[model samples]
Target: MTAVQRLRSAAVLSPPLLWTVVFMFVPYSILLVYSFWKTQYPIFVPAFQLGNYMELVRDPQYLRVLLRTLKIAGLVSFFALVLAYPYAYFLVFKVKRPSVRLTLYMAVVAPLWVSYLLRAYTWKTILGTQGVLNSFLVSTGILSEPSSIFLYNQAAMVLTLTYVFIPFMVMPIYAALEKIPPSLKEASADLGENRLATFLKVTLPLSMTGIVAGFTMTFCLAFGDFIAPFLVGGPDGVMIANVIASQFGAALNWPLGSALAVVMLVIVLGIISASDRFERLGAGRLT
Candidate 1:
C-alpha cells in the first residue's frame, strides 16, 4: 500500500517472476512458433497452417505410438503407486526405529543422485545375452542358454522406467502419509473399527493427495522419456518421445517434431488441469 512496502514486496517476488518469464514463457513461445511453421523443399516457411497437427491426427503410426506412450506411462504410474503405498504405510505406521527408517528411505532415494544415462546403461549390462542374470542361470543349470527375453524390449523399458521413477512416487506418498495424524488411527480403533476398516476410512483417504501427486509426477516423466526407450526399447518400447526424436534426427522433420511436442504438451497440461480440479473437489469434500 505504501511506496516502501510495495518496493519490498516487488524485490521479494522479482527474481522468481523474472525467471519464469525468461526461462519458461520465452522458450515456450519459440516452440509455439516452430510448431506452426512448414518444413518443405529446402526452406522452413511460416505458413501458419495446421498441416503438421493434421498429419499427426490422421497418421495411424503417430496415433499408435502416442497411445503406446500413454499406456506405458499409465502402467508405470500404476505400478509405482502400488509399490510405493505399502512402503510409505510401513514407514508411517510400522517403523519404530527412526534412524533405521531414515537410513532405509535414504537408500531407496540414493539412486536419484546417480546419472540418468548411467542408470539406463546399467540395465543394458544386466539384460544382455551373456549378462549377469543369464550367466548365473546357466551356471545353476536353470537355463542351458542365455535367454534373449531380458534386453531391448517393452518389458525392459517399463521395468527400467519404473525403477528410475520409483523414488519420485515413494517420496510424495511418504510426505502425504506423514501428514496423517496418529491420533486419527487411535480414535478409529477406540470406535471398535478393525485395522482394515480404520485404514480404508482414515489413512487411505488422508493419503489420497500423495497418490495423486506421485501418479502425476511418475506419469509425466515416463511419458516424456526418450533415453530409457532408446537404450532398452528395441522395437516395441518405442514411445511418442522416440518418434518425436526421430523426426528431429533421422526423420529430418523439425516441424513435425514440434507439432508432436505441441500435442504432447497439450495432453500433459490437460492432465494437470484435470488433476487440479479433482484435488480441489476432494479437498472440498474432505472439509
Candidate 2:
C-alpha cells in the first residue's frame, strides 16, 4: 500500500481506537483501582485492602445470589432460543414479500428503541393489582378479586426480560436461517427425507452458529440486567446485578461492588469461552 493509503487507514481507525482507550480501558483501570481501595468509617479512603475480596469469598449470600442470577440467565436464554427459532424460521422461509419481511423484522426489534425503564415500568403496571389486566379479568368474571399473582415476582422479571431480549435472539438465528440455500432442502427432499428429517440433518446443524450467538447474547444481557429485576422483581426475584447496585448505591461499598463486578465479568467470560469451544466442536462434527 502507498503511504497515502496507509495514512488514510490510520486516520479512519485512530478515532475509534482513541475513544476505546479513553472510555473503556481507562474506566476499567479505575474500577480495578477502586476494587482494592479500603472503605473508611464514613468515606472510602485511599488505603488498599484485600478484605473486600476476602469477604466475597466467605459470603454465602453472594454465592446464593450468583447462583440465582445464573439460573435466571439460563432460563432467559432457554426461553429466548426456543421462542426465537420459529419466528426466525417464519421470517426467513415463510415470508414472501421482501418489504413485508423487513417490516415484520423491524416490528420485532422496535422495542429496543423504547426506553428500558419505560419497558420495565410498563410490565410492572400490567401486572399490578389495579392494572388493566386485573381490571379486565375482574370485569369478565374471570376473577372476583384482583389477585397478587404477577407484580414484583421472579416470574414477572423473567417474563419482562425475556420479552425485552427476544430481538437479540431472533436476529442472529434469522441471519443463519436466511443464509441457508433453498437448494439444500430440495436436495434433502429428493433423497426421500421428510421435511422434519431434512431440517434435523441439514438446516438445524448449520444453524448452530446462530444458536450459539443468540444464547451468548441473551445470557450476557439477562445476567447483567438490574433494572428489570429492580422494577418488577420483589425481594425473591433479586439477581446478582441488584446486589451489586445495592453495594455501590445504598450500601456505599464500592470495593465490594467492584469485587462482585469482577466476579460477574469472569463468569460471563467463562461462559463465552465454553460456548465458543462447543461451537467449534459442533462445526468439526458436521464436517
Candidate 3:
C-alpha cells in the first residue's frame, strides 16, 4: 500500500485503538497493579506481592463459592438453552406467517425492554414469603400457609437467572435456525431419514455455533451476577461475584477484589475462545 493509503488506514483505526488502550486497557492494567498491592491496617500500600492471589488459592471458602458460581452459571445456561431452543425452533419452523412469527418472537423478548433490576425484583416479589405463588397456593388449599422454600437458595438463583437470561439464548439460536436452508431438510427427507434423524444429523450440528454462543453468554452473565443472589439466593447461595463485591466494598480489600475480578475475566475469555472453536467447527460441517 502507498503512504497515503497507510495513513488513511491508520487514521481509521486510531480512534478505536486509542479508545481501547485508554478505556479498556488502562482500567484493566490498574486493576492488575492493585492485585499485587499490600493491605496495611485500614489502607492498602503499593507493593509487588502475590498474597491476595495466594489467599484465593489457599482458601477453601473461595473455592466453594467459585464452585457454586460455576454450578449456578452452568444450570442457568442449561435451562435457558432447554427453554429457548424449542421456542426458537417453533418460531422458525412451525410458525407459517411472517407477521405472526415476528409477534411471537417479540413477545418472547419483550422482557428485555424492561429494566433488568425490575425483572429480577419481579421474581423476588413472586417468590417472597407473601409473594404471588405462595399466596395462590395457600388460597387454593395447595398449602396451609405461605412457604419460604421459594426464596433464598441456589434453586431460586437458578430460576431467576434463567428467566433473566433466556432471551440471550433465544436470539442467537433463532438467528442460526433462520440461516438454515429448507433444502437441507428436503434432501434429508429424500434420503428416507425421519425428522428426528434429520435434526440430529443436520439442524443440531449447524446450530451448534449458536448454542455455544448462547450458552457462553448466559453462563458468563450468571457467573458474574450478584444482584439475583442478593435478592433470591439467601445465605446458602453466595457466589464468587458476591464475595468479590464484599472484598471491594464492605471489606475494603481492593487487592483481593481485583485478583478475583481478573480471574473472572480470564475464565470468561476462555469460554469465548471455546465458543469460537465450536462456531468454526459448526460452520465447517456445512462444507
Tell me each candidate's TM-score: 0.95, 0.92, 0.97
Full ranking by lDDT: 3, 2, 1
- Looking at model 3, residue 101 earns an lDDT score of 99
Once superposed on the true structure, which residue ranges of model 2 sit more than 4 Å away at CA?
A: 1-9, 283-287
Against the true structure, whose TM-score is highest? 3
Each candidate: how many clashes? 0, 0, 0
Residue 237, candidate 2: C-alpha displacement in angstroms: 2.2
For candidate 1, write residues 213-286 as lDDT tens digits. Answer: 78888999999999988898887878998898888888677888989998899999988887777766665123
Model 1 bad stretches (over 4 Å): 284-287
Taken over the whole model, the C-alpha lDDT of each candidate is 0.87, 0.89, 0.92
TM-score quality measure for candidate 2: 0.92
**lDDT of the structure predicted as candidate 3:** 0.92
Model 3 clashes, total count: 0
On residues 1-287, what C-alpha lDDT tens digit does candidate 2 reach at each position?
Answer: 99999999999999999999999888878787888887887968765888888998798999898889998998999999989999999999999999999999999899999988888899888989998889989999999999789788888888899999999999989998898889988998998999999889988988888899899999999999998878989888889998989999998988888888888888898989998997887762332
* Shift of residue 67 alpha carbon in model 2, Å: 1.2
Q: Pick the candidate with the highest lDDT.
A: 3
